[model samples]
Target: MIGVVSNSRHASDYSQGVRAMADFARKCLDNWVLTVNGSFEQHQKMIRATLAKRAYELFELRGREHGLHLEDWVIAEQELVHHNLNGNSSGFCILVDCPRDPGIITILSVTSRSLLVFQSRAMADHNPELIAVHLLPENIHPEQTAVDAVDGVLQVHLPKQRNKRRK
Candidate 1:
């Protein structure tokens, strides 16, 4: 009877594991469908909502100042854009998992002007910093490039430079 009980318990555990795996698979499929079906208009609406929320938070953080609403909105929009560029689900720090070794780096994006955003953890055990350096092209406008660190992830945006046609 002991052998029978052991087999039954093992089968129960196996079934529970299979159910968990199925649930995870279903969630992944749902997320993929949402991502694929999400329209540009929908994305823009979401961005606008995020900007509004961030602007409100900024106002609250500043002790609810009466004026500077436009300034707050602009800053909040920029902040939200930067946060989204970091590929974070929310405007929060994303913990990057890496093997316990130095010199491991991941390049997130690179522009035509060679401007790039790469992720590399500090080599030192103490005071580890997530380093992201943007190399700007000499002809590129400085204002066009924005660098921000969010949730240990570095985001660098480099707008394409427009070529001037001379007659």
Candidate 2:
């Protein structure tokens, strides 16, 4: 009887620990943001490659059917741009490692599809100007988005846009 009681207690403790760890992770990710290099143009290339891959998968799913390239591409976009592969709707968080001191930070634009940021450090002798852009996987409310810089890390909290259907 004592052994069974100890096992039950241990299981309860383990469950509590798991919950606590999940809560800690969520809190840590609350201020998470995606950081990008100075190369903004590369985002386009990456998007094209990803889209191509998804489109090809659609083609294979269609039993290697041809002449549906445009349709496949559109379908792929609808699948990927709206929802991630995992289909989790809790929003997305990406952490970007930055310098200890990022200097003056400026946000150029925040759209539903992407974010454009400009950072400048006049005091620095090298690379005084840097432009970074991050492409979002889902549409977000531009007005509701919050951007902040903490400890040289840029944190962007993006709230996903809700879809409303009219009756």
Instruction: Report lDDT (CA) for all predictions.
Output: 0.35, 0.45
lDDT per residue, candidate 1, 42-80, as tens digits?
233334554576788899999999898898899876644
The number of clashing residue pairs in model 2 is 0
- Highest TM-score among the candidates is held by which one? 2
lDDT tens digits by residue: candidate 2, 1-167: 00000112243332222112212111112323223223223334444555677799899999998999999999877654433222247544433334544343232334566654433342433221223435677776655655565665555666777788899
Error of 1 at 164 (Å): 24
Off by over 4 Å in 2: 1-90, 102-108, 122-130, 148-150
Distance (Å) between predicted and true CA of 92, model 2?
Answer: 3.1
Please give the range of 10 consecutive residues that has the lowest summed lDDT in model 2: 1-10
Model 2 CA lDDT for position 19:
19
